[model samples]
Target chain A: MSSKIRIEDARRFRVGDGFRLSDVDPTATPGFSGSDKDLKKELVQHDEEIGVLQEKLHAEKQNSLLIIAQGMDTSGKGGLIKRLLDPMSPLGYRVQPFGRPTEEEAAHDFLWRVERALPKPGEVVCFDRSHYEDVLVQKVDALAPAEEIERRYGAIVEFEQQLAERNIMLIKVMLHISKDFQKENLRDRLQNPEKLWKFDPSDLNARAEWDEYMDAYQIALERTSTETAPWYCIPGDNKDYARAVVKHLVVDALRTIDPQYPTPDFDPKAELATLESMD
Target chain B: MSSKIRIEDARRFRVGDGFRLSDVDPTATPGFSGSDKDLKKELVQHDEEIGVLQEKLHAEKQNSLLIIAQGMDTSGKGGLIKRLLDPMSPLGYRVQPFGRPTEEEAAHDFLWRVERALPKPGEVVCFDRSHYEDVLVQKVDALAPAEEIERRYGAIVEFEQQLAERNIMLIKVMLHISKDFQKENLRDRLQNPEKLWKFDPSDLNARAEWDEYMDAYQIALERTSTETAPWYCIPGDNKDYARAVVKHLVVDALRTIDPQYPTPDFDPKAELATLESMD
Candidate 1:
């Protein structure tokens, strides 16, 4: 059987002023196949080019990136962080994994801790969970005053703007895993001994409040997606595909940044080969 | 053919103290084979219980670490950084690959920039080359005042003491390759086309003043090696062996600091299994 696919067909993504996060299909499969096998095949195809691109960025050492992976628990943050950073040189990159803020941090502005964690020029910083935690968790749990929650969002955008102004590129990835995926993920962790350390009982309470969290995320995306930094909603049900999408975004952004070597006065290739003879 | 090796025999190193930087035998094959290999192996091998130790320390997340590497033009800073970090999770790690200091950085005290790169609780920060730059490069080129040069070493030790007080463990490495190996490396860069970008013509000019630079490095290491953050003089001609040695040093230090997971309030495995079934 043969079928015609329109150029404008399902691949098009719209984020209207009035669009709600729920209105967006959290589980909507965009491509021909939703299978993880298809994603592995597609992702592996770009491996060589992507590897070259990574080397180019490392060599150029121009732009510093702070990759914010913000999703609820079980959103594939850990897995995504591993895959994207695995191929690249760890020398110029870093990751900040935040849990609850310290008392000293809470006493100060939310961004203070993050400011300390930001990568210098020519470095890349990955935030497994970042400042957004204040807004997301605080809003859903009613842990803070309503005014305080509202203020944090504006504070986040302002902080991000300052980073952009300073030539730091920020990538905000919302690992959009559906409730179904979360349930299955939680189940897998239960049966597996190795994954025992990952299971948290309170996750059930979070799932109970899933709809409320969704509404909160909707507003979070709507308010925060700015011109300098746009939110890339990654369909994360299939873990491998989510990884591929994030890696695509990372390499594409690096390509845009285009890292280049600092023109050392001598030929490096010849220099490297000198060791070949010593063998 | 088997003979008993004594403890002192095993712990003994080839080159003694007071050797110049280029005096290091980069081409000397490390004990990678034979009885001598087994004799010296224990000195190189720290406790292999590193993983178990790290897991315990992962819980308290108490002490942080910073590994700083500094040396001349062909010194093995980049390679050192890679081997140290290759085994660990990139999640709680940061690397600062400093080039020329920014004017803003130069305006501040030399330690300010380096201080800013310190890792937080339970994280590790590796500097491919660090603040010792002002002393090393400046001394070699007569770029800084002798008074200023002398003062910073004491200040650097104090800076490291502060880090140690704050529970930041520091490990410094100076990869010592002999003048012979460096000459071979420089020639390789000049002769190969692929290494064109890395070739710096004046590397030979710098190599010409080899002894002067070695004296500078010797002074830097002597002044800065302290109880809290001692320096390791790694004989680095054998690239693979150097990588292996640095890898084990990191493992050794990290194991001693150790890491442990925080006790979960709920069984993560059970939670994960439940989540997996939600679909």
Candidate 2:
């Protein structure tokens, strides 16, 4: 029998902090020994703040927030979003899964396709895989050149700035899973039938050049983290710790928004007959 | 023999078109009329646009839209959203069913609770019965005075303006089902198990004073319609016609959005390598 539950429990704190070298199981290198108590405490405040901001934003009907997540083949983007947004009100939240560009999409400029999915005000939209693929995969596949990638990073800044100027919040997340952790993730997918579809053979090819992709991501982080749209590199070896961090970031962002109620309209009188009748 | 299909079709429309007219046969409303040829042609264009938006938005990976339907008790909100958004992308979109306001909501401003449900930017949110209920129900029960209703209307306008400022497109639908049509709707609901949940004997109380609600709605439309958001009074008697109008509105909105793809980045060596590999 496998020690799955123990490993699962250990997976929660295997990042940020240094893990005990002696306890490192043969399955994969453990990250850090973290305290769930700390993680739980941190998440409570964040969850509350998000709740308030969500309500305020909806009521104010003000700026909407869009979150875009991108990372390596097994970077845990899906897991990150799930944990980060679980506490949000289901009514105003949306999660969009990205896939291959369609024929119509191919006809338009890369950003054209994205512009159409912009959320209405007072909503939160999360991109599982964003336009970064144009740079990430295109460069990996030689579909695009460095000049194009450089241009996109700078252009992204402008695009994001415009949204910020108009009050649409933009947040980007990159799940940083180590090569060793990724292999474990791949193993999980392979062994489990339920997760089999998630594993694409192409992902194996991509994993081979992991270091090159890391360089690309490093450049992406440095070039794209702007005042308008900031990027957070989350540690993914420890799922719980990662969730804790993401939770904090989202709540912090929402609380900082501090939306207010639209001004009240009805007065105490004028319809005196009606008010009296309800009583 | 009862015409179930006609009743089903009628449920798809906005309220108040055929009910006030002379006696209704109650049996002849089912078949899809070929007379609406021009409208059908327009719907095809709308359908094409929708497909384009669905593709483009999916690629962009930015945000989602929520459409909320809100109206008088017998309003056809549920039917409209179900048919309109069903085929698009259910994963990226959501429909929230709001029951009576909670005590917490009543304690705050009328818009307080609703604020929690607004969609994020670049999203479409439809309200079945939104904050307007404060004006509608309050007016009906004499719970709130005229001054209060006017004030709430202003709040709604400000709230919508803020939503537009952010990116969420707002569409408020007031399904204007007539008194007789409402009776038929109630009868159908009671007769069908699937629809019984929608029926409430209390809905009959307001039916006695249909003109009062009409006047209230007219005031709502007059006060709340703005450039940021517009109020459409859909005719509920004819189901297909109503669906057509809604489909037209959605298509019109998406056309205005005209989403695009993000620019890509590239490297010359990488590009050359990819091209050489492909060759």
Tens digits of lDDT, candidate 1, B1-279 = 434333232122222455444545555534444354553453234434543444344445687778887666666777666655655567656778777789999899988888787887767788877898888877887878999999989998888888888988877877777777776766665564444445565566567677777888888887877767777777767655555566566666776675655556675655555555553
TM-score of each: 0.75, 0.50
Evaluated at residue A21, the lDDT of candidate 2 is 24
Q: After superposition, how far is residue B38 of candidate 1 from its true place, in Å?
A: 16
Give residue B145's lDDT in candidate 2 (0 to 100). 81
* Model 1 chain B: ten consecutive residues of lowest lDDT: B6-15
Candidate 1: share of reference interface contacts reproduced: 0.57
Candidate 1: regions farther than 4 A off? A1-20, A23-45, A61-66, A98-121, A142-170, A180-205, A226-228, A258-279, B1-23, B33-59, B99-112, B142-167, B183-205, B222-229, B264-279
Worst 10 residues of 1 chain A by lDDT: A2-11
Task: Quote the chain B TM-score of every prediction.
Answer: 0.79, 0.76
Which ten contiguous residues of candidate 2 chain B have the minimum total lDDT? B18-27
lDDT at B38, model 1: 51
lDDT of each: 0.69, 0.62
How far is A48's C-alpha from truth in model 1 (Å)?
A: 3.7
**lDDT digits (tens) for residues B2-113 of candidate 2:** 2112323433433333322123232233334455554445344456568557545544545445455665566567667755763454344556666678888778888777
DockQ of each candidate relative to the true complex: 0.30, 0.06
